[model samples]
Target: MTRLGRIIQRFQSDQGGAALVEVAITVPLVLLLSAGVFEFSNILNTRLLLSAGVEDAARYMARCSDSTWNNCVALGKNLAVNGAVTGGSARVTGWTTAEITVGKTSTAAVDGSGTQLYLSSTGTVDVVQVSTALPYSGVVFWDFLGFGTIDITASHQERVVGW
Candidate 1:
């Protein structure tokens, strides 16, 4: 047999190189998938935490507000901060400052349509809303995903029962 023919035969029979090539191709894909899952999970978890904080703030305002709404916004923001810091602590991890906005708005003003759903300028104020914006650039793959700093916003509203 010719030398080239023998070499060709050996190459065709070789299974070892095939496994190496397959691994080289598949390993990166596997790694990328794992990273994507981790990032997505982190995003979802953060959002849930923020949402819970907003809910707590809105509920408190709804039940507690009276003739005086003084510092009510501050109260809600503080409560939300506590929830964010405590709930997000996977082990001493917390944000020092989160963009939190708490305010009173009329049901009609936010009657389901507006750019700032939690805001009210006029009319009978009967709704308490807690809104928050968090910068989610801390995710492990956030940079890899090309999202410099995704701003995640969460808001919750509750009707003021007494006034």
Candidate 2:
């Protein structure tokens, strides 16, 4: 073969380390994809847990008298931790007694309300609002993605059923 033709043929025949190079390029991508999936799943799980906890507490306290409000808050914290537990870790570590807010309101904004504690209303028609503010950090892959801490809040309102 001529010089240029020989060079081209030799280059095409040199397949050494090609598989290694390909693997090197794809491994990181696969790892990143897997980490992202794990992170997203954790976040979704925590969100659902928070929602359930808030709703449960609100419903439970809705039927009780005002004297039992502390019980409602305590129950809310427990429910929140139970709901958020995964892989032996509580996703919402900020779920504490001080973070739980129990209040009475006259509006339907209970579901979308912030963590702020509204004044307790003594009226029979008032709705009890239970809310918690959770700090979310990705469990598996958050550091790899350079994501910062996220604050998620869950709130629910249930109308009083008894005096």
Candidate 3:
């Protein structure tokens, strides 16, 4: 056999580089999957935190007294962004009170039979809603992956119960 043919045969039969080839092919895939899991978890955690903060603010505003109603809205916005009535660090990075919206709504409740269930004489229930749309800034570069400007939106509503 020719020398080049013998060399080619030996190279083709060699298993020494097979493991390296497999690792090279799989390493990036494994890393990408791991990074995806981490990113998803991070997003989920941020969503949960935002939801909790919104719920807390809504509950606070719902139970606020009529006399303190003026301060309730501001405090509720603070709570939704900072997780505290007073100004403090935000629950999520880059979150701010500017992103939060606090509002009161008058909604009618109905049972499964479609009959109105009104507790107040006005036939409408007062609801406090807290909401925010926060832009997600991930640990990795999401924009590079074509996931442009992901926003995490959360909202919560609680029935008004004044003291």
Report the lDDT tens digits of candidate 2 across residue range 71-131. 6556655555554222234535556657778887565322354533343443224677889
- lDDT (CA) for every model shown? 0.71, 0.69, 0.83
Residue runs of model 3 more than 4 Å from their true location after superposition: 66-68, 111-122
For residues 1-163, what per-residue lDDT tens digits would candidate 3 score against the true structure? 9999999998997889999999999999998888888888999999999999999989988887647776888888787778788867878888877898888878877656878765666656888888989898676746557787789999988888874
Q: Runs in model 1 with CA error above 4 Å?
A: 1-6, 65-68, 84-98, 108-125
User: In candidate 2, residue 25 scores what lDDT?
Assistant: 100
TM-score head-to-head 1 vs 3, winner: 3
Top-scoring candidate (TM-score) = 3
CA shift at 2, candidate 3, in angstroms?
3.1
Clash count in backbone of candidate 2? 0
TM-score to true structure, per model: 0.73, 0.69, 0.87
Q: Give candidate 2 misplaced runs (Cα > 4 Å).
A: 1-9, 65-94, 107-124
Worst 10 residues of 3 by lDDT: 137-146
lDDT of 1 by residue, 1-163 (tens): 9999999998897788888899999999999998888988888888888888788878877877455776565565666767532243331135333477777865664545544544556644588778877777855677876878887778998977644
When 1 and 3 are scored with lDDT, the better candidate is 3
Clash pairs, candidate 1, are none
